[model samples]
Target: MSDDNGLPGAQTRRALLAGAGAVGAAVVLAACGGDEDPAGPGSAAPTAPDGSGEPGAADVVVRAADVPVGGGVILASKGVVVTQPTAGVFKGFSPICTHQRCPVSAVDGGTINCTCHNSRFSIEDGSVRSGPATQPLPAKEIVVDGDRISLA
Candidate 1:
């Protein structure tokens, strides 16, 4: 016997069950494996804008002593590198490497180096100083407000 839809009752029930199972499988697959949330644990919080009117720039600070002439250091807590390639000049860039999204492991001799894939970036302008990184690190707008630096 067929129901109003013209399919046998058992056939209709089977079809419904198959459809439900397919949906369930899809849901499971979606939740199985993927990249971790960018803001999850071990990830730094987004930087606050330094009010410089530049989009995506975040407010951040670096101790005048933390940066030295012709040198730089990565601020792991803020996901940025503060540099002073020359006396009285300061530059900031995202510490997260552009190549593989890995946090820069160190900065030496005005170069920001990512240990993950051996990518290196310049502290002067955040340009790609080496490979396998092809893109420059993003620079953040920074303002020296008194003894503190505000990022924008």
Candidate 2:
């Protein structure tokens, strides 16, 4: 038995409707695709914008005083970790763990720890102190001018 389009029976009509619905769902998903969210600013870090409005130049991730000697702070919003391995020396590195890209949650006992996979990194230079991450966290360039720590 033929319907208006000559496709077989009620079963065929049901299949056609289901297929169309699936296609519509796929289109919706494609429209929303991207590495960043479209709803708002992708990062909360404050940045100094050029007149053209493209930001991230000379952004201050944290105050020099905020990072403690022999410890670090995870700035998840900026994907950087600021550490003060000594009284006056400051360092920065990518906070995302080398193993699975999970952000390191804490700087404790002279190591940065990724809660996701138990990867440990040295606070002094972002080197891996233990596995399951064999690679070290990559360095992030920053300039320390007096009391401020800004991305370079």
* Top model number, TM-score: 2
Please provide TM-scores, in order, for all candidate models, with all chains considered together: 0.58, 0.62
lDDT (Cα, tens digit) per residue for candidate 2, span 82-151: 9999998988899899999888899999899999999999988889999999999999998887767877
Model 1 lDDT per residue over 1-152, tens place = 44446745867788899999999999999888677774678875544555545433444466567677788877878766888888888888998999989999988867999999999898899999899999999997777655456565
Error of 1 at 65 (Å): 1.9
Give the residue spans of candidate 2 off by over 4 A.
Answer: 1-58
Candidate 2 structure, TM-score to reference: 0.62
Candidate 1, lDDT over the whole model: 0.79
**Candidate 2 local Cα displacement, residue 44, angstroms:** 23
